[model samples]
Target chain A: MTTSKPTVFIVDDDASVLKAVARLLRSAGFKNALFSSAQQFLDEHDSNASGCLVLDVAMPKMNGLALQQTLAAQNSELPIIFLTGNGDIPMSVRAIKQGAVDFLTKPVNDSDLISAIQNAIETNQTTRQARSKLHELQQRLATLTPREREVLSHVVSGKKNKQIALELGTVEKTIKVHRAHLMAKLQVRSLAELVKMSERLGIISSPLE
Target chain B: MNWITIVWPMMAASILTLALLHLVVWFKQRQQVAHLFFAIAALGVAVMSGMELIVMRSVSIPQVVLLMRWLHLPLLVVWIAIICYVRYYFNAGRLWLAWTACYLRIFALILSFTTGQNLFFSEITHLKQVAIFGGETISIAQGVLNPWYIVGPLSMVALVVFVVDASITLWHQGSDTARRRAIIFGCIAFFLLASVGHGVLVHTGLIHSPYLVSISFMPTLFAMSYELSYDVLHSAKLAERLQISIIKREQAELDMQTQRNALTHLSRVTLLGELSGSLAHELNQPLAAILSNAQAAQRFLAQENINLDEVRDILQDIVDEDKRAADIIQRLRLILKKADCQLQLLNVNEVVQDVLKLVRSDLKNRGVTVNSNLSNNIPVVTGDNVLIQQVLLNLMMNACDAVADAVSIEQRQIHIHTRWNGTAVQVAISDQGTGIVSDDIERVFEPFFTTKPQGMGLGLAICRTIIHSHKGQLWAENNNECGASFYFTLPAYSGETI
Candidate 1:
């Protein structure tokens, strides 16, 4: 897939690392955003932006993990890649569990850092697209009537028109009309598309399954 | 009778001999002013006694009067000398009282010489031979006492007042010798006063006896000599105690100093252990940068269009990074030096900066901001370079540790200041964390005294030891705003390089 220049947001309290990492990423043809502290990064944070955070695990005021949590809370799809001077298993485990892309220890290999940033940026783009698709599905779902919403849930759950009718205590002809209106509102054609839309809006189970 | 005559003369001679012996001691040690005065008083008593003995043997009234006229001279000398002895030995006595006694005795002496007849006896009735002690023929006087004879008693009263006042003062003020002085001087003075009264009454025929003032003074003289001997024994004992204590004090100080050296070494080792992680990170930074720059340079060189300026900048950074790495190691090596402390002239600010370089990584890791206000005119101090660096390292590391758990990064600040303070140069390190409690400020410098759970508690103690060894002082105080400040002062370099 073709991609534009991906920015690597490098946040470290150490001036040397901030400058060094920024330069390294720059030389590798990646756009760089540098911040001395996590707070400064948070101040200029773009929640909608798709990039990778090459953040120092240990920083003054707010650390990498804390920033990761804040971004996660705000539902930002920006992937974080942690860089630490000393890597403790528990800290890395926590950062990864909080949706961080990767955890690397300094003096990180240039190749490894570049790959992690690549992976993170790729992941961020995928996540951003998925989030936007889910948002579209939610907006479409919001337009459906109560009867149509029930009919859509039954349809995504592998129910036939007659079974949905029986479950909703409606006639099969009435269930068919409600299904058509919901599908049109969701802008989907095949049952597969309708099922996928329902999954994205979390009408049934997770989309991964 | 024979025993009495021999005892009286023998006692008089013994007092004179004791005084002369003490005079020899006083001559040997001129600081013993009291001994010399005692000798003079004793000699005067001996002279008066000898003349009194002659007056007792006189055959005619005129001959008795002739001896009596000379008697006041020795009496006056004895009185003056005794006052001086009391003043010096007891370290007491009012100056005015002493002067009054001396001047009155002098006036009495002059009156005795200038008067037409004897100062004590205006008319001598006859020389009545009496059978005195030891079957000695002593000529008793039958005379009408001169009204001016009251001068003798009055002078005696003044001498009595002076001695009594001195003894009382010594009793109140003297620490070790008060009791002894009060008893010895008080008893001797009272005895002398009674002797003077009895001698006067006997000479005027109120009692039928020869003049016995000399004999009376003999017992008191023996008592005074005994007191003097006791004083010698007491002082010798005191001198021995003083010498022993001085030696013991010196030995204790030496042991403390030795312990300090060992503890300082131990603390340095401990500090190295603590900083080892940050040191690795510090070294890794430069190493990583240098590697990256070299790679970058090689990549540029391989390119068709070579970027010479970029490659030059990259190579320059690598060189600088190499030096930075080497500088860290050099600082470490100097601090870890295992040798006896050597004194050298060092800029206080330079020492502090060197230490800060060593701990820069650690401070960054802990998110502590260090603010150093090194004065431009900071004077050089004479100290062991490595030891001073270690002191600063320990102090700065301690300050960093102190503020590690502060609520905010802004609160986690360590401030270092160095300035010239006239006679000395001072360095102060302050932290904005939990300040040392008032009671623990001094105790912080005691070995094995620690506030940290993981601390071996020898950092401050070792710092203090190192500073003290350099003839400097180290102390800690709580800051008004927050946390604690540790200060050390080193003597300024005085052109005398060690």
Candidate 2:
């Protein structure tokens, strides 16, 4: 898929503050989306959208932390930066514990909000990149036939071809051919790369045990 | 050396002593007119006793008759004095009755001097020696009885009727002191009757004895003196009790003042805790906008291709937001500042609006929608503005809490109304929460009485105190439909209109 430019999503109940923050973000050369409420944001949320959410923690319904919980349940990769008018310690601590990028109090300094947004956007990018890479790897793993997949699991578990052939009740030549074909399909240039790929796919467990 | 000579003089001296003591009392406290009348009566009685002694000792009929005629003057003085004393001391009597009695006695006195040799005799035929007080000899007059002698007894009967009538009026007044006074007056009437009856029996020749009317008059004087002295003693005790009660009332006022100050302080603290969150949000909104708008303006200015129009808009927004934040701070300062109560003429509707503005966000957060019906015709009221606002804030806050857990949006409504009720401006706050527990309706305004798990319970109590100090009233009642309504009234300003 073609990657789009990351957009900062800002959700705040306060209209003037929301407009002002959006203006600041625009001035700072950031693409931004605005939602006046958590429900509005939730309604318009896109899983595939790559960005960080700057959320006010004291909204009337579905406060920032509660939205964070909802997003977490949905396995969303959107990083959150909490903004509260008066942030208490326990609340800030809880927000940070629940995977919020930062908890900022309002009348937030421009540099602080900008930096927190930048940090959250970077976290979102890193998580999305990792997810996509895992998706690509899973696609590559799906290309192997059943016999090649069995051979790859045994080979990555540090099994020699003769021991693998004995366990599979197959000839050593057949086991070698299956391993070579699976390695080519997985695009590994060396045995170390093959073993690393097996570890990434969680196929290194000894099937005989 | 008859014992009558010594005893009559002794009785005269003792009655004179009593008169002198009361005269001194009347002189010191000139307001004691009753004491003055008692002194006059005692002195008259004393003079009568002296005259009686001379009559009893006279050896000739002419001497005895002359003394008897002069004795009527003292008798008339005593009768008038007793009438005046009873009238003044008891503070009750028929005025016409008293005047008639006095006039009748005066008529008898005139009759004694003009109608005959004396009121008791048309003529004294001879002087007779009589034995009295165990056979000591004293002279008595024997004569043809004056038909007008009946006037003397008639006057005494009138005096008795006057005293009895005054006593009955006093008895019907139904106070402990008045009843006691009535009893004393009854005694005076009985003594007067006995003296009159004795005088009549002796003068009518029904018994042979020296004229002892002066001695008989002594008991009536003694009864008058006892009543006067009892009054003096009772008044002194009353003055003492008045002093003690005055001191006690002053102490109680001081204690109330101290409690009021403490409650004011406590209420401020409680208000701060309750409003801090809303205040932070209130202040932060404008501050956040101001900061962001300013920074955005800076960014726009620093750019090579700066948009001056946008920058101007940003600066304008910044100024507006700054003013908004300042306004919030000013309102908060007004609420939290500790100051002596300074009363000023205030518009009730304005006070309601100010408090509603302060708690707008808080009520919104609790999902309570306030409906205000403020009457424009409300007259201005004199009150401490901040204190009145505090009262409104407290009531509104309670209204918010009342509806916080309501099952429906309709039940989360609060209605505040203000209007002039002729003499005073009244404000009522009604909520759609479940009505207060019928028993807790009044108790809710008592200090430290709360239904909320975390409530300090001083809100309603403090509100009431503030209202009372403003010469207003605050109370709560369950609404007919669904909730409790709190009502308070502030008297319209009666001073010069501002």
Candidate 2 residue lDDT tens string, B1-498:
767788889999999999999999999999888889989988988888888888878887878778878888888888888888877777778888888888888888898889779889999887777676687877777889988988888888888888899989989999998898788878878877888888888776677676677787788788888877887898899999999999999999988887787778669768767877887778878988998999998898889999999888888888888898889889888878777788898999999998888887777556577899999999889988898998888888888888989867788889999988887899999998888998888899898998889988888888898999888999999999889899999998888643
- The pairs that clash in candidate 2 are none
Tell how far residue A43 is off in model 2, in angstroms: 0.8
lDDT of 2 at B95: 88
Model 1, A79: alpha-carbon shift in Å?
A: 2.3
Local error of candidate 2 at residue A186 (angstroms): 1.8
- Identify the runs in model 1 with alpha carbons over 4 angstroms from their true place: A1-3, A139-181, A205-209, B1-263, B298-306, B373-377, B406-411, B419-424, B432-434, B452-456, B480-482, B494-498
Candidate 2 docking classification: acceptable
Cα misplacement distance, residue B245 of candidate 1 (Å): 21
Give the Cα lDDT of each candidate.
Answer: 0.80, 0.85
Worst 10 residues of 2 chain B by lDDT: B360-369
User: What's the TM-score of each model vs. the native?
Assistant: 0.58, 0.57
Colliding pairs, model 1: B1-B134, B2-B134
lDDT, candidate 2, A1-209, per-residue tens:
32788889999988899999999998898899999998999898666788889998876646688799999998887888888787789989999999888888888898999988888888888888887887888899999999898888788778899999999998999998888888888998888998877766777743454
Q: Each prediction's interface RMSD?
A: 2.7, 2.1
